[model samples]
Target: MLRHLIARFVFLLAAICAPVLATPAMAATDVSTPWTDEDFASLRLISAQTQTGSSDTLRLGLEFELQPEWKIYWRSAGDAGFPPQLDWTGSQNVGDANILWPAPHRFSIFGLETFGYKNHVILPIDVAIPDRTQSVAINLDVDYLVCSDICIPAAATFALDIPANGNPDTSTSGASTVSTHAHEIEKFVSKVPLTGDNLPIQVSNVFATKDGDATQLHLSVDGLSNAGVTVDDILVESPLRIGFGAPVAVNKDGESNNRHFTVPVFGLNADQDLASETVTVTVIAGPLAIEQSRTVANGPTDASAQGEPLGADTMAPATGAGANIWLIGLFALFGGLILNVMPCVLPVLSIKVMSAINARDGEISRVRSGFLASAAGIITSFWLIAAVLIAIKLAGGSIGWGIQFQQPLFLTVMTIILALFALNMWGLFEINGSDNLGTAANDVINQQEKGGRHLSSHFMTGMFATLLATPCSAPFLGTAVGFALAGSSFDIIWIFTLLGVGLATPYLAIALQPRLAHALPKPGRWMSVVKAVLGLALVGTAIWLLSILAVQIGLGGAIAVGVGLVLGAVFVWARKRSQNLRPRFVFTALAVTGFLVALFAPGFSKPPAPSSVSTAATGPLDWQTFAPETIPALIADGKTVFVDVTAEWCVSCQVNKKLVLETAELAEFFANDDIILMQADWTRPDPEIADYLASYGRYGIPFNAVFGPNAPKGVLLSELLSRDAVLDAIKDARSTAGLASN
Candidate 1:
């Protein structure tokens, strides 16, 4: 979201630094200039072929490699520093050298967000050759700000020559091409977002809105459908020098390929005229990058009062309230209620079931109290999450539901806790109050203390349930969370509270009617078997998290954690089975050591690689990657398309797959030569899938839709899908624009 709209703003003074101490020389390869060394950086001109043989233009690259901690700024350079300035005045036979900057990574240091490239970066520049038969002598003078703990301005000059006439060598793809720095230059060139009409991503609409002292940019964009890749952040390059913060997706539904965003405009007063201005909008979502020039228009003012994000005004309550807020609150409640039934929530559901069964023969007072404690736990945990999110928002950090799953540390801790729960469930270890003091009277005291301990555990159970429920987005939950995330702090706090209440509603209901617990089977020998079965469920959940860990870090880190947990489980089993105290002590020591590995491994491990690679669609159902833009064309051609937006962590999605889509009837229907099945996997966080789900105003997964001639837009399916619903929708989709032909 770093756009250098710096016409009026004063640029940071780039202090000239001392000469580059020492560095290894880089080979020129004839087509490229040797590394022009600087204090903390090296610059070079690189090209695949020096000759412009059979080519109209000479493709070249200006590459920079910085010291370990130094970085060069992007176009806008963020809150501090300036982008590199290149002067090609001394060049010969070069019409105009246009340097294309690749997308930059955002870095926040001491509360200031900056955009730049660290380590190595290449700015691909295409030097237009006016005369094809003339030799081009390219001379470049570059000045840039490179920063680490401090900012330093460095200058360097580089030169390269492209000879006139020689038959261009054919590349591996059998095309006349430049092949010197071909792969390296092409990679950097690809990083440069597509512009003009070539952009797959299209900005449908853009407008500016102002409220009080705050100005905002509202945008509508289309063309985002990439598997596992998240296309979220939007940057604005305005001709009027208007600065825009990173835009967040507005949870509101739109057309299939389109999504909306709201950006906070910096250094713009409410009095400034914003309409009719031209700006280049760059949307970066992992590998899917595109930019478009848009004419600004006026947009609808906020129905409610707004304030600057991360400002004191934001900390206060919003003055005006809208009816939609209430509706969102209701949705939040319903979403939370739905979460209890989500397949991913089974781990905690099992705990609640056990609590109910144990209470079946217990005192009514204890039953009510235990359930209330659980309810309280859920409510308290939700508030805690809200508080944290509020803080993050205030700090201008990216915030979202279920986003914590993306963190390796969070995944590691969760795996360890769940693994221990599984071990305890399997009777490997029994949690009791006394490690010692085995006196008869102390035993009586322990018995007396059991009730209170059970209640506390019930609360913990509710908290754990809330944590597990995050990965499953129920229908209303996504809308409510999205609404809150985009709204004032009050909205965030209030909506999340409603969601907590909604999720705890069932628990509250059971508490109100203690007789319900009495209806369940009383405790018996059968309970132990149930616990063991539930233990397997937790183990499965842990394994799923580990797989995500593998994706986050590397396979090696994930294996380290997995092995630790498995060994810990084994040690627990031994400790319980062994009769000797000495053997028990040894088992305990070994178990702690094993569990510690899971605990500390992620913190010590290196971070995951800079990029994530998502593979092409592969499945038995002939499921292609979900591309909503392609749907209209296929439907135009009389083909029926079924789009399934699902995530790996979504258990309900798996259930729907087993019961509906993957069923023989639907399978055969989708396998039809005319039928196209597209699946958007939300196994990893994906902005496109999220936006697609939001378009229908449905947030939670297990989302499916069918499109055809009759249902050109799409026919939505139930959240908890059924086989009949799937077939009926497909049938409806296939129903004729003219007449039913299938």
Candidate 2:
């Protein structure tokens, strides 16, 4: 038993260690530097002189010229990297060099979002130059990283002279450039339409609605009723995730007395129901930007609340910490029971039950041995799974469930198993009866396949079927495993053990029943038909597996899968057609050719997807994606960051996604520079990503850590989150990042 366990353990280890080969087209060596050779990668200062009587009137600026295609870190760089650091020490007669960031873009990389600049970006700084000084020299030192395929450290010292007698005309270049970039950045950052004093717009009402499966935010503006005056720019600041699925045009022509606007929340799918809650909206009209905080009726609000909207802040408080171990264990047990219904486990159960039906007349010892052998297979398979997970975690791979299936090779293996099983069921190969078969007629006939009687075969079958079951995790299983993954090692073992036992219970019950062996059906012609049907089912499943090949490898590569299948079928057919020695030679040649083709399939030899592509964005973030590094930078520049780490297989993750992450307040909070929200997808295990989570002292998903100026270390949120909770975090992070106290 120990040897068997060791062998299984070794195989599991090997599977995890196997390289995910990269194709030449997708493979590239890591660059030595994150900065472009020609770029001024750190901070620069630009100042504009204001009119007279303005005691030290000058707008100071922090300009960052990032390399083309490469980016500098944001306040929160998401899963990795640090935000840019700037210090201003050497200065004459300057009270403080306050940095004013125009806005930042959300940058998505390797399944994480960060807010920062790509190409060249300049953040304008506003400084009140004291009039008493004849001349002012502003000296600043900046440290930051420039990243392309890899990151490189960069720093620069900048000093700018402000002439006490210089003409306002001399400041055109600095003034114009700063103004232009600020407007450009704002264009991208403005998701929630804010109505500050700069925009002459007033919100009469703000409503939240569920449009089919998506949540949407509707706005009614009071001052928008004027004719000839239009609402050209509409940005939202609320946390109800909202975006335009189609192109949106805001033309303020001042014709109507009131105007209503609606935007669909991005990333939120159909996994949740809408609820009533207080919300806020930011409206940007002609020359004013108005921010209106109000309590909107929650969960599909009615039209009665329109125009009478009470402006109030209704942000929800974030849930602190997490549930205890016992709660998680209960969730795990329920998850285990649900695993019994997964399609992946169903077939294996069918095979076992069928075996039991056939061996009705076998001795208690033989029947018990078969049952024990199957049970052993289930347990052993789970051990192998746990071992692989543990090994990968040790190897710095923060992998989650179903991540292996993302690889084409694993899918190919599944395809091969289903195909082989189908062919066998079709009676392409036959064997003599097993020595252990009882006197039952049905047992005698079907047990002819002595190869399946081997303990190893039963074990392999259990393991293989479990692999198939990885994709369809029951709701209970997801929460259980999710909790286990986030908890202590002891919890992981016990939770997983409970699941294994749950899966093996049926087989155990039949094994313990000795007299049940006499119930086997008689061997008859109907048996052949049943086997043929099973064969067809297997073949159908194989085809389904083949169909998924197109998602990872393009259509041409999927065609290769079909060709490989045909080649394998031909080889099988050729073997069946041959009876003579010369024919055997032809059959052997065909089989070898088929084997080579299967091994050489183009999809099998490719490298795993790059570390830059994140599959977690319900779809994909807008072109302007953000990172974690942007958080500190935004805070330093006075902005908030909302961090979300989620996964596809995690049902709870999805539920929260539809509920909070995709809400307008949240999405707009992310879209605006006021608060930068970035998502880290833990759907697939990447070593770099694993290292990232470990840095946070977490080993699993649904983890949220929010950072603000007030709370730099970040407040860890509970596994289950709500829309209000997210907004409150944003408010806190914003207050902290924006320096509310100082």
Clashes of each: 5, 93
Please write out the lDDT profile of model 1 over residues 659-731, one tens digit for every residue.
Answer: 7777777777676677888887655545445445544544455677888877776887766787777878878
What lDDT would each prediction earn against the true structure? 0.69, 0.53
* Candidate 2 Cα outliers beyond 4 Å, as residue runs: 1-330, 347-350, 430-454, 514-520, 602-742
1-742 per-residue lDDT for model 2 (tens digits): 2233344444433443332331221121221112223453544454433222124444554556665677776454534567667776887656555444333344545545444567666554555555533666667677787777778887767765554544433322112112112222222222223333323456655556775676666666666544224444333433544332211332234325566555445565466433444444544443234566656555323353233222232211111112335555666666656667755455445455446665676667667667767667666666656666655443323445555654566656566656656666665632212224323534643564343454554555556556666655565565567655544456567777776666766667767885665566766787778777767777776666665555555556656776876787777767766676566567657755764565458446443353343456653223123255446676677655566676554445666777777766656656655656567655433433433454454445566767776556576676567777766766665664344433
Off by over 4 Å in 1: 1-321, 391-399, 430-454, 547-559, 600-618, 626-642, 671-675, 686-700, 703-718, 722-741
Q: What TM-scores do the predictions have?
A: 0.52, 0.44
Cα-based lDDT at residue 736, candidate 2: 44
